[model samples]
Target: MTFSIKDDSPLVSVITPSYNCSAYIKETIDTVLDQSYPNWEMIIVDDHSQDDSVQVIQSYEAMDSRIRLIPLANNVGAARARNIAIKEARGDYIAFLDSDDLWLPTKLDEQVEFMKSGNLAFSFTSYSLIDEQGHSLAIEVKAPQTVDYKHLIGNTTIGCLTVMLDRKQIKHIEMPDIQPEDTALWLSLLRNGYQAHGLPKILSKYRIVSNSTSRNKWKAAYRYWKLLRVQEKLNIVEANFYFTKYAYNAYNKSRGLQPVSIQNGGK
Candidate 1:
C-alpha cells in the first residue's frame, strides 16, 4: 500500500515513440506529468514526424528537464525509435508508451511498488481502450495474475503501455523489427525462462486510431502467424495451435468480452 519507496535514483524511464500524433501527444505527455510517482524520466524519440509534433514535444521538454526528446534525422519505424530510447535510458526500470496512448495518474507508482514488493523482473497491467478522440470504449481488459511464455504465446494480453521491466534482469534490451515489436520482445524474454507478472489493475489507456497498422484484421492475423513461424521457429502444427488461441482472444476482446483467464497455470 505504501508507494513511497525510496527515490534515490531515477526509478522509471518511460520510452515513447512519436510520429504524426501532434494532436494527441500533448495529452499523452500530460498523463505522465500528472503521475503521483515523481522519480521518473520520459524519453521520447520522434520518428521523423512531418507534423508539428516536434514543436509540441519541445515545449514540454523545455518546461521540464525530465522530458527529453530525441528527434531522428530520418524516419525509422517504432521499433527502432523505441530501441533508441532504450539505449539512452538511465533509469532502473524501463516502461513503454506510445504517443497516442495514455496512463493513469498512479500508474508508475503502483506498478513500481508491485514489482518491488514481489521481486518481479517484468510486469504488465490491464488497460482501457479509447477511441481516436479519447472517448472510452467502455471495456477494460483484465490481466491474469501471471503469464509465462506459453500463456503469452496464445494470449497477447500484455499491453505495451502497461509494461515495466527491471533493467538489471534484461540482458538484452532491443526490440526486433517486426509488425508487433512489443509482443515479439516480450516473447523473446518469456521464452528464456522468464515469467511476466500481470497486475490486474487498469493503469493505462490504449487508443484505437482508425488509420493505424492494426486496422486491417486479416493483415494483422497473417503478420502474427508469420511472427510465430519466423521469430519463434515454430512448426506448422504448433503455429496453428497458438494462432487459433490468439485469434480467439482477439475476437473476444473485439466484442468487449474478457479473454479467458489462465488458471493456476496455463493450458
Candidate 2:
C-alpha cells in the first residue's frame, strides 16, 4: 500500500509559512527537526514579517542544511505564502505546519506510515491545543471517521499543520487566495474526486493563543461563508445552509460547548 517511488523511500517536504510569528517560530522548527523520521526537508516562507520572524528563520536555516528560508518582499498572506512554498518543494510528499504549531516527534513518521498503509493521497491527524507558553489547554478534536466534501462544509476538521499530501496527486493545484486557505484547498481536492483520510492519532500540537485566527470567531464565520461562495459556487440556499452551521458552531463554542465535530451523519 506504500506509494510507488523509484527511491527506497520518498522524501517528505514540510512547509511552514510565517508572518510575525517570532514568538513561536523556534518551537515550530525544533519540533520538525526533532522528528524521528529522517527523510524530510523544512521550507520556511516568510511573508515580509514586520517582526523578527525572518531573522529567527534565518538563524535556524544557518544551523541546518535541511532548513531553507524563502523571504517575500512584501506581506501577502498565509495562503499565498504557502503556495510559494509548495511551488518550491522537491519531495514526493508535501506536509504543512503553521509557524505557531508544533509536531510531536512521531508526527511525520506515524502519518507517513498510515498513508503508506492506506494508500492515501492526502491525510491529517488529530491534535491537542496548546497555549503560547506551550501549556496544554485541554482541548482536543476527535478525528472524523472519514473526510469528504459533505463533512467539510460545516466545519474544517482537518488541522492544516497535521496535513500531508502526495505531491504528484496535487502538483497542479495551488492554495486558493482566500482566508482559511487550508479549508479551500481541502474542498478543491474533494471536489476534484480526491479522498483524504484522517489518522486518529494526535500527533501535533495546535497553538491557540488569544490572537490566533480561530479565536476571531466572527472573522472565521465570515471567511467560511466567503469560501463557500467563492469556491463551491453555491446558490443562496446552499450558502445559507453552510452559514447557519458555521454560526451555530461559533455560538456554541462561545458558550463553552465542546467544539462541534463535523461528522457526516447529520444529513
Candidate 3:
C-alpha cells in the first residue's frame, strides 16, 4: 500500500518526551531512523534529565536534520514536555513515541495508509510488550476496532506510543497535566465529536520498565477514576459505573489477559 497518497507528502512530527532514559533512548531513536516511511521528523523533548540522556540524544542530532532536540530549562514533567513539543510541531500529522518505546519499520507507512484510506482523524495500533532488556515478552495488547468517549471511559487500551493524530482535524491539542495525560487527551478528543479508530496491526513495542507509572495499578486506577470525575465531569453514579469497569479491565491487563474487548463492550 502507498504510504502517502497525496502528491505532497505531509510530514509526520514524532514527539517523544525523555526523562533519564539513557539506557533505552538510543534504541528508541534507532527505531525511528529505521522506519520505512521517509517523510518524518523526530522531536525529542528532554524533561531536565540528569543522566546522559541529553548527551546520547545530542549525538544523534548531528547525523540527521530530521532529528531535533528540545532541552527544557526546568524539570516540568512528561505531560508538559509533550505539550511543548506538540505546540512546536510543524508536521501535519503528530505521532507520539515515548523515550523507551520501539516502532517497527512499517509502523508509520502502514498506519499512515490506514488513516488516509479510512479518512480517520485519529488512529492507534496494537503493540507488543518488551522487557527492560529489550527482549520481547510475546504479550500483545490489541486495540478495539473503534472507540468513542464513553467507550474509552472503561477501557484505556490505546497506547501512547502507537497513536497518530491528524493536526488538521483536531485543533488546540494540549494534553492535560495529569498522571495519565495521554488517556486524558484521547478522551478529550473523543468527547469533542472525534472518534479514535484502532489499527489491529502490532506495529510497536512497549518497554515495560521496572517501577514505571503503569506498574502501579492501584495508583493508576485511582487516577483513572479521578480523571473520570474531575476532568470529564461525570456524576457520582456515572463515575462509579465506569470506574468499576475500568478496575475490571485493569485487573485483566495486570494478569496479562486481554482487557474487555470491543466485541464484549465490557459486558
Candidate 4:
C-alpha cells in the first residue's frame, strides 16, 4: 500500500504508553508539545500508574487540546496499554515514544517528510542515548542502511521512540503480547514483507535509567531467547544468530564493557 501526502493530510497520532513514569513524564509531554510539526495529536495512556503520572498527564491535557489523556482502570503491561492507545488513535499516521524519552523538535517533521517522500509504510530515525539525569552519554546510534527480518533478530537497532508508521497499513495489525512489544511489532511487519526505511539522523533521546529494564541482564536475556524462538517459527536463521549476539552483548555490558561499542560483541 502507498500513500501520497496532501496539504490537508489527517493529523498524525503520537501514542505514549505510560506507567509509573513520574520521573520523566513532564519532559516527555514537553517534547511532544515542542514538535516543529503542528498537525499531530498526543495520546497518552496512563496504565494505572501509582505515581503522579496521571496528574502530570492531566495537567498537560488541560493546557493543550491536542494532548489527550486516557487513564486505564487497570494496571496492564506496556503492550496492552499501547494497543489501547492505538485503538483510540485518530490519525493518518501513527508514531510511538516511550514516556522516558524525548524527541528533538524536528523529529516528527523530519520523519513525516521522509515517509511521504519515500511512500513508506513505516520508518524510524536514529537517536542518542542519555543518562537518567538527561545528560548525554556520548552514545549515538545509526540504524542499518536497510532492515530485514534477519537483521532485526538479535539487536533491536531501531529505538521504539523513533518509529513512525502509516495507520492505513498498520491499523489492523496489533502489537503482540510479548516481552519486548516493539521488536515483536517490527518482526510482524518484516514477516509480512512491509519494508522499513530509516532516516540516519538523531531525532530522539533514549533514556537509560539505572533501574530500567535494560539494566536487568538476566531478564533481558530470557526475553531475547524467547523472541528468538518466535523468529525461528518464521524460519529466520539470521534472527537466531543475532539473538545470540544480543545475549552476549547484554552479559558483557553487565560486566562493564560498553555494550554499544564493543566490536564483535553481543550481550
Considering every candidate listed, which one attains the maximal TM-score? 1
**TM-score, structure 1 vs. true:** 0.94
Error of 3 at 51 (Å): 0.3
In model 3, which runs have C-alpha deviations exceeding 4 angstroms? Answer: 1-7, 261-267
Please list all clashing residue pairs in model 2, or write none if there are none.
none
Q: Write the per-residue lDDT of candidate 3 for residues 151-240, one digit (tens) a residue.
A: 788886889999999998887889998768999999989888999999998999999888888778788877898888789888887888
TM-score per prediction, in order, is: 0.94, 0.90, 0.93, 0.88
Q: For each candidate in the order shown, give its overall lDDT on alpha carbons.
A: 0.89, 0.82, 0.88, 0.79
Maximum-lDDT candidate: 1
TM-score quality measure for candidate 2:
0.90
What local lDDT does model 4 show for residue 234?
29
Query: What digit string (tens of lDDT, one per residue) describes model 2 on residues 1-267?
Result: 122343556789998899899999999999988888878889999999999999989998988878999999998888888889988899888999999999999998898888888878988888887878999877776566677777677765678888999877776757888878888899889888888788888899888789877789788877888888877788788788777776775565344344465543322
Estimate, for each residue in 93-175, the C-alpha lDDT of model 4 and write its tens digit.
98999899999999998888888888888898888888899998777767555676655655567789999999777657578
Judged by whole-model lDDT over C-alpha atoms, candidate 3 comes out at 0.88
For model 4, the local distance difference test gives 0.79
Number of clashes in model 4? 9
Cα lDDT of model 1 by residue, 1-267, tens digit: 123446463479999999998989999999999899988889999999999999999999999888999999999999999999999999899999999999999999899889888988899999999999999999888888988888888876889999999988886888999878999999989988889998999999999988888878888898899999899888888888888888999888877787764333222
By lDDT, is 2 or 3 better? 3
